[model samples]
Target chain A: MPTDHIMKTYDDELKRLNNAIIRMGGLAESQVAASIQATVKRDSELAHEVVEQDAQVDALEAEVEALAMRLLALRQPMARDLREIVSSLKIASDLERICDYAANVAKRSIALNQAPVAKPVYAIPRMGKLAQALIKDVLDAYVQGDADKAMHVWLSDEELDELYTSLFRELLTYMMEDPRSITAGTHLLFMAKNIERIGDHATNIAETIYYLIHGTPLKEARPKRDRSSTSVVLPGPVAVATTDSEETK
Target chain B: MPTDHIMKTYDDELKRLNNAIIRMGGLAESQVAASIQATVKRDSELAHEVVEQDAQVDALEAEVEALAMRLLALRQPMARDLREIVSSLKIASDLERICDYAANVAKRSIALNQAPVAKPVYAIPRMGKLAQALIKDVLDAYVQGDADKAMHVWLSDEELDELYTSLFRELLTYMMEDPRSITAGTHLLFMAKNIERIGDHATNIAETIYYLIHGTPLKEARPKRDRSSTSVVLPGPVAVATTDSEETK
Candidate 1:
């Protein structure tokens, strides 16, 4: 084949790979949303659907992996072509894990429904929606090949994390006041966490995008001191004692 | 370099990368464990230490990434070498996130202790221990290249998930009984979850290791249908509300 023909062929392969991933992502996004509903409404059937769909995701993951491997072995692609393949592998893994988290949420929802739940099912679904959008935005970024779009998705993670923190506080108090709340409270807490993890998976996709474009990580600016307006405090000066205990353990 | 010299040099470089990763794993594990103690004991200083130590983990992640890039460029190694380098990148990402989860747990601890906690804070610490060891063992499997060990650690994720689920349920029951327990219960929930996330990260590492050694994903046995003989009753049909309430807005 002529050099241009070879290049065109590789590009076509990459296009196919990206499309495959997008299809996989659609399933992943829906899985996340459905999982939230499953838990919120105690719909075990939706949970089963999410779990069963994981197999399809897995099959797609394998297909994409094979395509990526073929490109590497045959074309030895460079630059964006190579980056595209690497991103596919990472995205497949993230999507699979997001599904797992959704199933977990569904499972928890069923558990909480068994006995009267401690509190109204307030923040968990909101958290799930945020997570679902993160997945959607990241996938949109991939489809558009827009780095800025990916960056926007990355920023949303902070808000999700903050929401999770608030939810965590509420749940912890529930457990303490009535020991009975412990069982149902644990289920809700995991449901919230499953949503948080989905956010992390979305961030992973964004991070892969960063590497694909710049060959550098999405370098986070670490705060040297307390950056938040609120002065975040530690428990006490038990660092040494904790260190000793760690040693003994 | 002669082929033999090239072989030994490759081995040496791989060993250095492995050692650095193992050291990073140890540091990450300790960070998770200490963060748990900070939360359970309400030790603000240790919580600060955990937060401060996260920077070190981030730095280590960068160093690993830089080294992996050098190998990719300088060595021009084959697929096996490439797999090893990619595995390192994946593991660094996992470790960095685990550290973030730990820091989160510690931060929550500080928040919880500022007010009177409502529940007994016993299980989170133990969960942290299991999670930290999972990180350690997964790394050990990668370094020693024991696929079996890695698989063993991967299998334990289910048990960890169960523990977190139980903890969640207990917390919810508390919130249901009394409104007063909300805040403390939620904080404890976050603490348990951070530990649980550490276990998930460990599984991510093990999955990466399997890829590195096997030149593919480790063959996962068909995950049997979740008999879900526990709290979640599966196979429930979905019901849709055909109408929206007038107060929906």
Candidate 2:
């Protein structure tokens, strides 16, 4: 075959690999949305369906990995092509994690369904929607090689974090107000956390896309506002000591 | 230079890369240990030290990535060598995450230190020890290319999960017994979760090492016994209906 023909064939393979990534991303987004719906409607069947659907995402991840490896070995792609292939591997892994988080949400939804509805479940589903949208936008950016769109998705994760903080507080209140709510409230808390993590994974993909396009990672610190229990406040100069006796009381 | 000289140089570079990984892994393990000590002892200075130490891990990760990319682009290693370089990239990422989890734990320890001890903190320290050990063992496996040792680290994560479940139950009990405990209990819960996640990352490294040596993923499913709120029991053929009204009350 002529060199031009070989190059054309390589380009086609790259295009097919890109399509596979987008398909996996779409499946991941659907899993997140379906899991949230199952949680809100207390529909165990929908949750089960979401769990079953995760196998497709897993399979796609394997396919993307194999194809990317083949491209690397056969084509010996350099610079931009190298970045694209590597990013595909990284993005597929991130998508798989997102799918796992969604499946986790589905599992939690089933557990929550068995228990009483502890508190009004509004914020978690909102966070889920935000996470799902972020996944869509990032995958679009991946397809278009649009760094701007990827940055937007990356910056928007703070909203999901804020929503997670509020939900964390509300769940704690519910569990505190009525001890009977503890079991179900805990499940909701984990589900909310799963959604928040899904948002993080979406941002991860955005970073990968940005790197693929720009040949450099986003330099700024990730925009983060998760004020949950793990949110770290850097200590002031000297550790301010509170009276231990007063705290124990 | 002869082909033998070029091969020698490549081997040396690979050795340097492996050393960097082990160094990063050690820093991560120390960070985890310090964070746990700070939490248990309520030593804010120790926590601050752990937080500050994370920068080294981050720098090491960047170095590892550069070296791995250089090897990939210049050497174009194939088969096992390719897997080794690729797995180094992945293991470095996981170590970075483990370091972040440790830093998060330290930050939470500072936050929790301001409040009275919510409950006896026995289980969390034990879980931290287990997580730290897993990090150490997995990294050792990486250095020795010991798949069996890596598998041991991977299988041992279930113990961490079980410990986390018991700690979750204990913390919930403390919060329910005293509303004032909620503040501290929440922080402890997050710390426990951070430790649990560190263990998960260690398992991720184990998986990578297993893949690196065997050229195939471990066939068995990851052993998981996290009976936390997220653990799901699939519904039977017939949905077992509970008295929802009683649960609400």
Candidate 3:
């Protein structure tokens, strides 16, 4: 009877830990979606609400961390069980960062409201939608222990990167054409970057999910198309002037 | 005798875990410094070397994760011991990210080398120096389990933020003044942001160290002065024209 009771207690604690992560994930998804809506509509009130809602995500992260630590000490879970608890800690950290990026988008929306519209705000909203979808899909994957769903989310991040790169070039063009647009354009650029980073966090979660189920790190290289600046590999040294025109594009 | 043997084995594993993190921290610090050197000197070979060195950091992270999980499952350490193992995992993750950012700076250096010089690259190197110093100090704090040193590193991130904000404005001015400089200016902006993020990861380490030693979070809000767009708080709707000039400055 005592053995059965201890087993039941362990199962209950595990369920609670999973539920905490689910709640945190839901909060993060809503915060990100609302922040994007606030930016696109220039609704400062909505933006303020997104900023205020971030506190809940932060608190939930703390709760998840505490619970995971307690499980580690008390249960001494082995193999897959250990992976599940540790991965929860990692996912919670990623979710918190996603919430932070959402808050950044909200804050930038306010500053963007103060400036004249630089360009039609189409791409950033698209990127945000993609990022939010990835977050949701990865969380569902976590619940089901579905590595296939997580892999799908991981592969789709390249699309977000492609969108970001094109938007980046367009923003630069706007700023260059009209010096007056620099202020608004810069804020828009940051918003796009924030969404891009959220996409990265989603990828991190997907990778974590894969590790949890498989008991091994994802061995494949992450599909990446972020060719903005950092990923560009150069050939042998050539005259700087010759490459200037090619780079300016 | 059996209990003594088990305790000794546990202590030895903990020492190994600490050593792994210290090694990873040292590698991350060197990578950051080398990438910055590669950027300032426009040395493609050195930049390539930094990129290659990242594999070692990634391997070290995996090793640390494995060791931590082993310790948790085998020892079921209570209280402070549990915190120490979990904190090592978190610190190792942070260190890996810091190394990734350093690799990013190196990648950008190759791209920036192909373009004509945008502005004298003074501020970014200085920012890199500050970030490198923070990484070193936080690692020392981790080794000593000194909460005070960790807190000091946590507070000093504000200086990096101030420098980043000033650098941000200067980059915008350069891009606006000359359309031709946009490509190079954009790359430099990313490098600066990368350094700023390294500072953030350093602060993350500080927080983790504090939690490990003190058994509680650093309850004080992190000191922040990053007033570039995302940190700005908006007042009630004012004349758009009135805010435009202020924003440009």
On lDDT, the candidate that comes out on top is 3
In terms of docking quality, model 2 is: acceptable
The worst-scoring run of ten residues by lDDT in candidate 2 chain A lies at A240-249
Q: Which residue ranges in model 2 land beyond 4 Å of their true spot?
A: A230-249, B2-5, B230-249
lDDT by residue (B74-192, candidate 2, tens digit) is 88888888888888888998998898888878877877876667564777789988999999999889988999999999999989987887677667666666655665677777778
Ranking by DockQ: 3, 2, 1
> Whose lDDT is higher: candidate 2's or candidate 3's?
3
lDDT tens readout by residue for model 1, A120-140: 377887888889889999999
Q: In candidate 3, which residue pairs get closer than 3 Å at backbone N, Cα or C atoms, i.e. clash?
A: none
Candidate 3 lDDT tens digits, A74-145:
888998888989999999999999998999888888888876665747777899999999999999999999
Best by DockQ: 3
Q: lDDT of model 3 at residue B24?
A: 98
Model 2 C-alpha lDDT per residue in residues A147-249, reported as the tens digit of each score: 9999999999888887887677667666566665665766677778788888888888888888888887766768667767443212223222221210000
Per-residue lDDT of candidate 3, residues B1-249 (tens digit): 999999999999999999999999999999999999998898989988998888789899999998998898888888999999999999999999999899888877887887766574778789999999999999999888899999999999889988987787777667666656665777777788889889999999999988998898876667676667643222233112212211110
Worst 10 residues of 3 chain A by lDDT: A240-249
